[model samples]
Target chain A: MFQGYTAAELTSIFAMQGFAGLSLFSVFVLMALGLAIIFGQMGVINMAHGEFMILGAYVTYLTSNFFSEHLSSMFSLYFFVAMILAFIAAALLGALVEWVLIRHLYRRPLDTLLATWGLSLILQQGYRTIFGAREVGVTLPDWLMGSYAITDMIEVPVNGLFVMCLTILITIGVYLVMQKSRLGKQTRAVVQNRAMAGAVGINTEKVDRFTFALGCGIAGIAGSAFTMIGSTGPTAGQLYIVDTFLVVVFGGASNLLGTVASAFTISQAQSTMEFFLSGSMAKVLTLLTVVGILMLRPQGLFTLKIRS
Target chain B: MKKLQDFTRNPDAVSFAVLAIVLVFILPTVLEIFRLNLVGKYLTYAYVAIGLVLSWGLGGILSLGQGVFFGLGGYCLAMFLKLEASSPENTAIQSTPGIPDFMDWNQLTALPWFWEPFHSFGFTLFAVIAVPVIFALIIGVAMFKRRVGGVYFAIITQAIAAIMTILIIGQQGYTGGVNGITDLRTLHGWDIRTDEAKYFFYYLNVALLFLVLLVACWITKSKLGRILVAMREREDRVRFSGYDVSNFKIFVFCVAAAFSAIGGAMFTLQVGFMSPSFVGIVPSIEMVIFAAVGGRHSIIGVVYGTLLVNWAKTTFSESFPELWLFAMGALFIGVVMAFPNGLAGLYTSYVKPLIGSIRPLLKERARLYETPDKGGPDMLNRGTAQ
Candidate 1:
């Protein structure tokens, strides 16, 4: 595939493609992080996780419109506000879904999939009804509008950098919340042993609800970042769902590091291959490879040795 | 003679007889050709639903990628039909007269190697069933043998559906692309687009459905069915009892794939085209809803479920298009939460009780019962353990 390109040109191509893959990896990481929490940690397959992300995107859309209309002077700062509101909005809905739908289906993991799928459809239609079916793009502040030339041959979009930076921050936040915080400890307790955790005075129900909401909140943040690089549509969430789930599963559902690693591997492979093959073929090859590897190592790229 | 007596004495005999009457006599007589063809198309989905009842409901192997099998079946027959339709004389206007239209459009001068075998009708028929089943066998063995199942199985299968869609749509030159294998004109020079052919295909579809339903009924009623339920409730116990759990899982998965493929072939015949729209995650999951709404455990019930849901979808989408998805969403939630057993469960729980109250003696003699829901809570608790 690279037969004709000079060595310098090949180096630039690899550098540019690698950056493209890095941005794609950021999106997958954002999407899969929430899924890893909901599905991996809690064993509840929230098929609507994509919808939750889209909810964040929609929230950002609304926020951007609001900011440009009223808070024109602070329009550049609206993204930070939108990201916060997106988290709260998605988290609130996540809590409501847990109370009404997920709590009852916890014992039936597969049914959660179907029910949440239904929820996703309703959410998709709800977005369509409220926001209209056409794809919507958020207005970027002047700072996020330009591309940074890394070298003579390679340039990266500023919004891609913004998203990449946002991903790093949120991933760190998630890591801290999951590993360092008291709430994280309690949530882990509940996940590891619900009955025992309850006996030890951990509000297991509250923890479950909060854990689910937090996962959804992170997805909302991912969505907020999503608006930086791409357009959002009512059905856009559906596009990310299978891929996100694969990331979580391929990472060894319960392993956070695994999710990130798998996301990086999948995104890089796909973007790099896209240069050589058709876009669809690259996707097909990447997914086929992940699925094949998963077949061989069903436990995934990483696994925890905890007894079930 | 004993088997014949068992057939008559079977509790489902009346339900089966009623379904047969409805499909054979009432539907054909009452509905017009267009409406009847629509029903025929809906019944094609019932093939997938029936398969889900076996593999998902009974075997506890929830494959969200049933559409891949359905598409495999569809594309197999479509390849044959496209070959016949692309006979050099039929495509004399094209630059490449003998190849499929899409292939020629993509600037291919010759037929692809894969399309070569589809020219034979006998091979096409064999390939329709064989291809999907073999694919299912590969997936089933790879996953089940490793004890990968439940949600993992569902997710993996869904990914496969996504892959299949991209593959079919990407390889447009070979698979006819997103436009699908259209302008499918004949089967052995029998013009299938005609009303007479529609009627013939409708009846053929109904007969095939009944055959499939009977096979499903036999599977769910046999000792194998008992083992499946047991496996669903407690896999470790089944394995401890020396049963090859993966073998049962693989067998049912293959059976389900075969059923779906048959449905796909019929769909291609009646619908006159096969597209990626039906071979993707959305349609695949929608097919699951068909089985779910009808009562996944009830083989006969899934057909009714398929018809009812499709009928309502058509009517609802036509009149109140916006609310149709809301209704579908509600149906999925309602079926899972309020009535996990679906319409069949509702019948057994509420309607059967009311009928029994009206005639006490008749209830004992003619009661229509399926395998009890002994495994429902058992399976849920098992899920909790996992």
Candidate 2:
């Protein structure tokens, strides 16, 4: 398909597509991180995970509106405030849902899928009622609007770079929390053995609620980052749910490193293919490859060697 | 008197009678042709729900991609009907006289290879059943044999559903795109647009539904059904008992797919179009809700559940579109939390007992005029008399 392209032109195309794929990788990693924590560690299928992410998006939308209206001179700094507020909003709701809906469905994972789906429907409708059904876009501050020319042929969007930076910061923060923090240690203890953790002085329920909240909070941050690249709508969250779930599953549900690796692979393959095939076909091929690989390697790309 | 006792005692017998009365006589006589046609459309979903009862409820295989099979079946029949509708004489003005209109619109001059066999009615009917079953076999074998069950299986099936919808929509010329295969005029020279034809189709749909229901009931009653329930509860134990658990799961999954395929084929015939809208993630999951609301384990309950939920959807969406999602959301939560067994469980627990207590009063009235020798082996009556 690229037979006619000169060597210089081919290199330029690959660089541009590779950069675009990095932006996509950032989104996938953010989405998959939250899902991996909730689904892999907690064993709850939060089908409404996307809706919660959208909740963060809406919160960011509201925060942006507030800053632009009242503090127009300081609007460049609005994104940081929006990200914090979005995390808190999503985490609070996550805690409440864990208490009310998810706790009862802990034993029945399949039922959790259905119930969360229902919850997603309510949340989507709620978003439509409040935000209206039309897709909403945030006004990127002037500094974040333009692209940087890395040579004449390879230009990178400022927002894409910003999103990648945010992803890297958050990913490191999450890694430190999971591996180094006392709460992370307790959370892993509860996941490994609930009754034993409870008996050993850890409040298992509290750990569960916190872990779920933490997962949801990251999703909120992802949503906050999402505004820079894509528009938000009531159903926009849904468009990413299947892909997010696939990434998490394909990466090995419990492995954070695997999630990141798979996200990069999927995003690069898809974005590269997008240059050759139509957009929908690219998506189809990417998803088909993931599912086919999953069928052969049902345990996914990585597995912990823990005996059941 | 013995027969009466047996009728009241056997839940299956009572359910059969109720289903027969509703589908065979009451619905046909009371509903107008248009409403009857709507019921027929709802009944198509009942097939999918019934399939879920076997696959998810019994076999513990929750396939979130039942819509793929449903669409395959619908498109198979739709392809034939479409080919018949777009006869060479009907399309003499087009660049391609024998090809479907969508193909011609896309500037294709020849019929696609896949659509050729669908030109025959016999092949179309065979394809409707065979296609989905074959597809199910492939998916079922791939996943179940590898021990990929539960949420992982569900996510994969869902991905398949998403892929199918995107494929159908993307290949507009071949699959008719988002508009779907519209303007389906006839089925084997019979004009299906008329009210008379609608009435005939309704009966045909109802008859097919009952046949599927009977097959479902038979499966539930058989020894294989016992193993399915066992496998669902403790798959390891079932496997240790010398059964190939994957084969049983595959078998039930295929059976469910076949049932759903029949429903999809009927849906195309009754609704007059086949589209990707009905073959996507949303509709596929909604089909699960029907089974859930009906009592996932109850075959008869799912049929009623499908009708009632779809009816509520139609009425609620018509009257107040904003509130329907709230109601459906509440329904899902309510069903899972409060009534996991669904309406059938409520009926069996509360209503059936109430009826059982009231039945003795009627039996007492009958006993007053009957001789002792005529009582036969009525255990309840015998105990009461003693």
Candidate 3:
């Protein structure tokens, strides 16, 4: 499969594949980061995290529609608007779900799993009812569309570059908020020791809600970026949700850096496998390996929570 | 007199005979066939739910993989039915030889190699029970023996189901593809069209349900059940006490798989069609829902849970179909949030007290009537077991 290229060309091939993987990693991180906050921090199994992301995708869809009809030529920048809009929309919905349904079942972790699963089904069917069962195509702005020519021998898709940039911006933004800000301090404090944080006047309830909302918000951003590469349907989020959970789990839910590392590892492996094998085979192989490794390290790739 | 009273009053033994007789001889003759069919279907669900109660409620495994077991059994039975129906001797509504209809579209001329054993009823039956148990045992030993629990366990099993579905879908030439093995025929050389045959199946399911229930009751009453429930409550204690926790988990998982297979066989016989959806994540989750809503800890709850659940499915789907999912969402949230024990739990904790309080005013309808419905709460010492 690799005979045609010279040494320079082969280096460029490596570079191009590396670029492709980085973009995929970017998407995986954006999705898993929010799940890590919810499942990792709060100890709540939020199965409807993907649907929350889909809500973001829907916001992007609506934004694009608004751009096409009302703004006309400004369509080139609809993605920029869509990304922010999706974040707020998803965050608002996340907060609403937190207050209305999820808040009621805090102590019972397994119940949340079943309840959220039902919520996922409801959202899926609701989307089917509203958006029609078939997948809707979202139009990308022409300027952001197509590929970037890295070299004569290698080419990378431009949209992939765009997704990577958004991922970086979101990651840094999350990093700043988590590391530098007061809210970040409180959030981490609460995650480490909820009772102590409460005793220390951290307003842990607010932190919980905000942390959950932030994760949902990030998931929404992921959904917005996902419109470029994937289908936007009632079940579009389902495709990402499993792999997202896998990344989150494999990365170890409590650690952000672990998420990024595992995301790159799994995506690179999956993509490389896809190149060698078929798509389903790649997924099967990735999942089987993941399941096997998880059995060995049940706390995930990175362990937390006592008994060490 | 004491021996005779003891023999007559043992509810598990008594209920078994009563349920079998009513289902076999009485219900078919008295009620319209429609109601009988509904009751018949509930009996099959009861069988499935009992397996879930043991696997999830007792063993604390909370297996979301029962659907895969159910599908294995259903396909096994469906294969036998299809083979028997497709034979040259059977003339009515003839299907092509070796090709289930889905395979016709997929352009398959011959039977897949894996499906050859299913041509024989005994082999199909054996595969139904063996396949699911074998898969669970391999996966269980791989994962459970290694001590994977909680969310990771559920997610991994779910992924297995998803991957298997995708594999089955991709292999359209084999395994009946997505549409699954349908058009079931005569069971054990008896035509399924006759009302008598339907009664036979319904009775068979009822008998099987009673048998499974009895087995589950006996197991729950046994030392193993004590250790399994104890393991669920506190694994460290059991481990410290010299019991191998993984061995107990694997044992119950296999038992659960076998029961689910039996339920699947009964399900196919009643529903008259078997589809890939039997093994999908939805059905798997729904089984969990059934167990959850019916009180996962209670065995008798299994019967009421499956009945109430399927009843709700029929009612909601029939009456207000669009709002059903939302209602279902609310139901899960409600059951989990408000009532951890589900309807069965709700009944025992709230309704029983209110009824007992009210019963004093009614002045003994009988000098003493036996507890109805959920009387067997303490039969196998379940409350104490936990």
Candidate 4:
């Protein structure tokens, strides 16, 4: 397919492509991480996962507006505050959902799928009602609004770099929480053997509530980051849900590392295809490939200890 | 008739049979044109919901692919209507050539190859049903055969439905894309715009609903019905018992596809239009919610669910458009979380007692010997009845 590009131009394209792909992968990984935590660990199909992300995005939007209007001097630092606020807001909502509705549903995991799906619709509609049906544009702080020029022809959006950095920070934070912290140990114990964890006084109920909330909180952060690249509408979360699930399941459910890997792979493939094909076709091709892969390996790319 | 005995397995048969007879004879004349049109639309969705009830509610498949089948049926009929409208002898075509108004704006050339068959009404009707069934059978065989169930099954089906929506939207010239197929002339030789024709369409919807509900009830109580339930419980156990679980799934899926196709046909006839959004994930999920809210396991539940949902949609949207979806979402969550048995469940828990207590007085109609009509083959054991 390559025809008119010189070596220099080709090198520049590849360089710029890497930045775009990595940033996209970061967003995907963030979305999938939350899903993997809930679905893989609890065996609950949280269909409202995308809605959680939207809530987070809305939080970021609100926070940005607050910072812009009330404290303009801290405008650059506003994104940081917004990210934290989004995570907390989304997490609190998630916990409320867990305590109120999802608590009764752990016993009926399959029914939870329908219940959560319904919950998602309700949340989407709630947002639509309050915010209006049209999409909202979340403005980026001035410092993060521009691009970085690597070569004469290769320039990368500074926002993409910011997203990549945030992805790394969140990944490590999640890893430390899961691998190094007491909460992580308890969560792992519960996921590994729920009955045993309960017998050992691990409070599996609390673990589930926290895990679901944490996952939702991460979704919010992703949503906040997403405002940089995409529309923030009632239905915006849907555009990412399929891709999010593909990443989570295609990698290994419950495996953070696998989620990240799958995100990179899918994002790279999709971005590469976009260079040669139209946007919709790229998406179709990417989904077809994921489906084909799943047909062969139904357990997804990774089969963690508990899953087959 | 002697064949009435075939409905014995279905507990609701007596009521439905009596209702159908009355409907066939007099319901149309009694109902107003406006009410008739409304009920017609409801019936089409009812058919689609029944298909979901059988596949997802009863069978435990949570199929998000009903939209795919609905689209297949809808697009097939839409093509027929389009061809019928744009033909040379047709009055609409005499004024304008090549493209419908929507496509005229987009700059389409000749008809796409796949659209060629729909010019004939016979072919269109056949394709409307056949297309959805074939697609469902192929997809279901590939999926259910692999023993996919639960969230895995739900997600994949959702993906298929999503992709199909995107495909339809992208192929604007052939599909009418976002706008979908609208501004139609008539079906076969009848004028769609006339109140009489609308009444006829409504009656057609009613007839199809009765027949489909009868078939679904029959199948759910048959040998295949047992296997479907067993497959839901333990597919391997059924397979070990010398049945092809995959084949049963494919059969049910195909049957569901046909029901959905019929729904789409009735839907298009009543609306005089079919759009891409009609077959998207939202509609598919709406069907699932209808089944869930109505009580997934019952055909009667399907009827109640569709009516409840459509009523809420129209009423709420008119009063408060933005709040409608949220209210619906809340309704779905509330129903699923609080009333797992759905509204039909309330009837069983409460109303059935009243009916049971009063049953002795109506004993004259309740026949003897634990049998229905008489000596005909059990309706369900005959075929993939549902």
Query: iRMS values in order, in angstroms?
Result: 0.5, 0.6, 1.7, 1.6
lDDT tens digits, residue span B50-133, model 3 = 777777788778777678888888778887788776665453333444456555566666667776777777788788889889
Best by TM-score: 2
lDDT per residue for candidate 4 within A30-143, as digits (tens), equals: 898889888877878888888888888888888888988999899889888888988998899999999988988887776887788778888887898788889987778898
lDDT of 4 by residue, B158-233 (tens): 8888888887787777788888988888766778989988877777778778889889988988977887898888
For all predicted structures, in order, the TM-scores are 0.95, 0.97, 0.87, 0.91
Instruction: Compare candidates 2 and 4 on lDDT and give the better one.
Output: 2
Best by DockQ: 2
Sort order, lDDT high to low: 1, 2, 4, 3
> Candidate 1 on B77-154: residue-level lDDT in tens?
999998999899988999879888899999888888988999899999999999999999999999999999999999
The TM-score of predicted model 1 comes to 0.95
Which 10-residue span in candidate 1 chain B carries the lowest summed lDDT? B363-372
Error of 1 at B78 (Å): 0.8
Better of 2 and 3 by DockQ: 2
Candidate 4 stretches greater than 4 Å from native? A1-11, A305-308, B1-10, B18-31, B89-96, B99-104, B360-386
Tens-digit per-residue lDDT, A171-196, candidate 1: 88899999999999999998888899
DockQ of each: 0.77, 0.85, 0.52, 0.58
TM-score of chain B of each: 0.91, 0.95, 0.84, 0.85
lDDT of 3 at A300: 76
- Rank by DockQ, highest first: 2, 1, 4, 3
- State the weakest 10-residue window (summed lDDT) of model 4 chain B: B90-99
- RMSD of every candidate to native, in Å, equals 7.7, 2.2, 6.6, 6.9
Clashes of 1: 0
